[model samples]
Target: MGAPFEIGYVFSFLPKLLETLGVTLLIVAGSLLTGIVAGFLVALPRMYKIPVLRTLSGLYLSFFRGTPILIQLFLFYYGLPELLKPLGFDLSRAPVLFFVILAYGLHTGAYAAEMIRASVEAVDRGQVEAAYASGMTSYRAFSRIVLPQALAIAVPVFSNLVIALLKDTSLAFTLGVMEMTGKAQTLGTLTQHFFETYIALALIYLVISFTLEKVLLAAEQRLKRHEAREEKAGRSFKLRRKGSYRAVLADIDAGKGGRL
Candidate 1:
């Protein structure tokens, strides 16, 4: 007989589930923040086509995008032990959590670098040239003119990658990192609650991903409305100022320029 999924088990496991939820968020957010920052730096250089860095970014992106993330994780977790032995570094002695974060960060960074580089290139060359023509330094042009628009374009794709990163946190179990999935697996085996355990875990993941997507969608809305806000505010301010000046001029004209 298929074991009935018990709501009571979920209620009992609530505290433990919440704790694991936090751990899942930690790994997801930590890796994404680190990866995006690193990717931005790499993408910036590649966008500028900097010497050697551009080619290196291209190669790095190609290699990571070309391979499965599972293989990448395995390489970092297993291969690193042997590879770093020559340098007197023992993987087993190192912080396993740190390696999990590092591997996730590097893997995500490669894809993000390529995405950002593409977004940067998609920005209008004329707009960038206009900034340069207006006496903007290359750095200033990028800061003020290029990044804002590139970021706007990249947000949707980046949102998808965030979801992917969250899902990928499951892969951490192989590296001995006790995250959400690890916790779930441990608890399931201990309690023999496979069906109930997975159902609850799935719900938790769904809730988290949904909440994150909502926040990202809200941010995207703000970004998309930015130009419209600026225009509306500018128009209103100009109209108010013009109306004030017109009233003053009309009063003076009505008095035939006499002091009043």
Candidate 2:
């Protein structure tokens, strides 16, 4: 039979679980960095519609997105070493954390590719044309105008992804990496207080998630403020142009009246 729940034990387990929080965060950070770079590269072929590369990118996305992350984790953690063994390279002795990050990163890249593609597509094409008309190169226009807008559109979604990644780090424990969840499992076993241990773990996750949300929300708001200022400036410029046109028309009427 399971031990009775003890509320006091929850508090006691908190510090022990917190000790491994950094490991969990490290997984998220490493995976996120890897995912962003891979995602952008993967997205490029699709965005430009390159022939063979586009097909390969599509397949990459399909396999990663269609499969469960757990399977991917196993594949990388176990299968990859064997695959590399035939090539005279060995990964059997590599750090477990490395495989964890790689698997998560690849999984994240698949999702991020879609996010990046959609975000970039959401930007107005007319702006790019306008930039072209102003003599800017395609690269310049994209970098200066399109990328900023796309980033603004992407940030909210990316924030959600980050939160998801943070939670997903729990799976890293399956490979015995001793992350937060792994630590909780050990604590629970040692103390025989599964309920309290888990409750403490849940609380830690909640607090971290909440803090991340708030910080990302503030960043989103800051980006929106920049957008707001640009819009205001645009409105003022239009008003000034309108006023100038009116003055020109009035002067033309005065000249015609004098001639009459």
Candidate 3:
């Protein structure tokens, strides 16, 4: 029979699991940074419709987004070294953590690429044309006009991506990286308290996810503050105009009554 359920073990496992939380965060942060840079590079080809590069970027996005992340991790951790051996660039001895970050980054890049492209396209074409007509160069117009709106649109999606990445980091333990999940596994095995250990782990993840949501929500609100204000002002203006029109109609009816 399995070990009896120990509610106390859940509390006991918290500190040990927390010790490895930094590693999980490290993986997320590293992967997020790498994904952003790679995603932008990948997105450019498609955005500009570069001939060969656009095709290549599409294949890249398809491959990464199509495959499961766990498989991608294995490919990077195991298959990459073998593929590189013929090129005289050895990666076999590289740390597992490196492979984990790389795989996660590439996986994240595929999603981020789509997010970035869509956000950029969602910006009004007229605004960009107006910028160009006003003596703005292509780079200047994009930087000054398109990029801000695109970033504002992308923030919410990026926040979601980050949260997903945080959760996905649990899979990194499959590669033997001693992140929080890995630590939990070890604790569970040694104590034979799988139930409590996982409960503790779940609690940790829930708290982290909650905190991230709050922070990212604040950031999203901050970025869209101007848009919110503009929308509010627009609504107010419409209401005022409607009220004035109603008042005018009421005055005309009263004048007709007086004449009658």
- The C-alpha TM-scores of every prediction are 0.80, 0.87, 0.88
The Cα error of candidate 1 at residue 143, in Å, is: 0.9
lDDT value, residue 212 of candidate 1: 82
Deviation of model 1 at 253, angstroms: 53
Q: Assess each prediction's global lDDT (C-alpha) against the native.
A: 0.77, 0.87, 0.88
Which residue ranges in model 2 land beyond 4 Å of their true spot?
229-260
TM-score of 3: 0.88
Candidate 3 segments exceeding 4 Å error: 236-260
**lDDT minimum window of 10 residues, candidate 1:** 235-244
lDDT of 3: 0.88
Q: List the residue pairs that clash in candidate 2.
A: none
Question: Candidate 3 on 1-260: residue-level lDDT in tens?
Answer: 34899899999999999999999999999999999999999999999999999999999999999999999999898899999999998997899999999999999999999999977876778778899999999999999999888888788788889999999999999999999999999998898899899999999999999999899889888877877897787652211112345334532425446331
What would the per-residue lDDT of candidate 2 be over residues 77-134, giving only the tens digit for each residue?
A: 9998999999998898999999999999989998899889977876767778899999
lDDT score, residue 76, model 2? Answer: 96
**What TM-score would candidate 1 get against the native?**
0.80
Model 1 stretches astray by more than 4 angstroms = 88-90, 228-260
lDDT of model 2 at position 232: 77
